[model samples]
Target: MTAAERRASGSLAIIFAARMLGLFLVLPVFALEAARYPGGNDAALVGMAMGIYGLTQGILQIPYGLASDRYGRKRVIALGLLVFAAGSFVAAAAPSVWWLVAGRSLQGAGAVSAAVTALLADQTRDVVRTKAMALVGASIGLMFAVSLVAAPMLVEVIGLHGLFTITGLLALGCIAVVFWWTPPAPVQHANVPRGRLADVLAHGPLLRLDVGVFVLHAVQLAMWMAVPALLVQAGLDKDRHWQVYLPTVVASFVAMGAVFALERRGYLRAVFLAAIGIVLLAQLGFLLAARAPSLPVLTALLFFFFCGFNVLEATQPSLVSRLAPPAARGAALGVYNTLQSLGFFAGGAVGGWLAKNVGSAGLFGAAALMMLVWLLAAWHMRAPQTPKTAEEVLADEAEAG
Candidate 1:
């Protein structure tokens, strides 16, 4: 990547990380913290409040993405951030659980993922886009780890309201980063034929990716709910689980260099399928670890999970950009993220049910099964075409005409 690409990728990764941190920060503590509010007694209702954010975010993603194409990426993103900040502040000041739900719902309404990712795609050359996206992926994983450690400590100091306030501030901070640091908007390819929702919806490969993301996030959200308890059973205290998570997440990055190497060698399909296999292996490991409850075993399993998780995260989005019509890239990603958000929402409900009726092993078993399914689907996916230059793009269009 050139210096400009590095700067763009770095700044956008931070922006992505900050938004996700705000979301993840609440997950570890929301149920506990919500109990302090009025009407927090009903567990189902409290769960509803948290789920609403994902629901609303899922609902709005495509519209926001389409709007970005019509208007502009930066404008749409800025507006979304403002709305997100407002939602955070509302959540902070809520007097009751229902209010908290309303606030969370508001937070989800500002969905800007499509626009943000589209801009990142626009600024970076395709040859380096996956590496750029890897940075974003790593940041997200890092934030999840940081949240696990920080949320517990931060909640103790400032309590739930303070956490909401911080989330709002983080959203506001992203707004500043957007205008001041992110690369200037790329010139839209207006001469390119406009694309439709059908273009994305009818595409088989994108559909596969959409399913893959859905499974990835659903498993991630559901598995984490059980993983912490497994760590506890392994003789690690709840407070000290970070000792396992932080190191595993950090160590996983060491494997990513190999992913980049293989991708550059034009083995992208091979790498993609292998990453899915690694995650499946991790899930199977979790199944065994759940039975025996060994800290060492669980830690090693986590390393493998993050390794596969980060690779899939980077490659999937890069492929979406490469494969989608130029005019419809944002819409395609919106669909991608919508499934992701839905997976998160569904994972909680499904995971809780599996854990309750079956056990930790059952939950991990289900997740492993899903990964196997995804791997099978991804096996048929075509390797991405090489990056096209402007002349190649125009020439191809002219040839088709």
Candidate 2:
């Protein structure tokens, strides 16, 4: 990558990390914190508040991406961040669980993930795009780990409302980074053909990657619906939950590096499938651990889960960028992100219900079933070919015409 690509990728990765940190910060504490609000006692409503961001995010991702394609990535991203900050402030001031849900929905309405990712694709060359995406993925995983540790401590210091306020401020700060630091996107001809949503939708390999992302996130959100409470039951205090998270996150990063090495060695498909298998095994382990409920057992299981999660998170987007038509990259990513958000919403709502009605074991069982299906889909997915250069993309289009 050139200096400009590095700057763009670094700035964008920070922007992505900051927004994600805000979201993940709430996950560790929201279920317990919401109990103080009106309607919080209803498990379903609390879950809805937790997951409503996904609902709005799912609904608006494609539109945001399309707007980016037509207008410009930076402009769309700035607008999205402002909306996110507004939503964060609303969430910070919410007097009831339902209000928090509304705020969360607003937060999701700011969906700029597709736009940011598209810009990254635009800035980096095909040869280095995977590494750039990996950096972004690593930032997200690191943020999640940091949030897990920090949320408990922060909530103790500032409370949930204060946390939301900080999240709003963070989003506002990212807006500055975008305009001042990130490089401008290279201009393409106005008359150049762009990818149609229908074309991306009809593509088989892209759909398979979409399903992979959906199931990956769905299982993650679903598992969290129970994991926090389970940690409490296993003798860890809610405030001290980071003790488990900290070590597991460190170990997962180490494991993820090894997995990346396999991909570098041209074993992308094998590593991808194996990562799914690890997730399945982790879910199954969670189910068995629920019966016996030990902190050590639960920690080991979560470590395995994060390993799989980090690997999949890093690999999937790169595959999407490589496989999709260059002209429609933003739209394809929009569809991909929409599915990912839907998975988050579904996992939270359904997982909460399962936890409330059937118990934690049942939630894990459901997640395990989803992973089994994803594994099958991934098993049949062909490896994505390397991405073409800009000249190649234009030449291919010319040849087709």
The TM-score values for the models, in the order shown, are: 0.90, 0.95
- Give per-residue CA lDDT, model 2, range 270-299, as digits (tens): 888998999999999999988778999999
| Distance from true location, Cα of 37 in model 1, Å | 5.3
What is the Cα-based lDDT of residue 336 in candidate 2? 92
Name the regions of candidate 2 deviating beyond 4 angstroms.
Answer: 387-401
Off by over 4 Å in 1: 31-48, 95-97, 189-195, 388-401
Pick the TM-score winner. Answer: 2
**Which residue window of length 10 is worst by lDDT in model 2?**
257-266
C-alpha lDDT score of every prediction, in listed order: 0.86, 0.88
> Which candidate tops lDDT?
2
After best superposition, candidate 1 residue 274: deviation in angstroms?
A: 1.1
Clashing pairs in 1: none
Which lDDT tens digits does candidate 1 get at residues 217-318?
889877765787788788987667678888888888877888887887789998899999999999999998888898889999999999998889999999
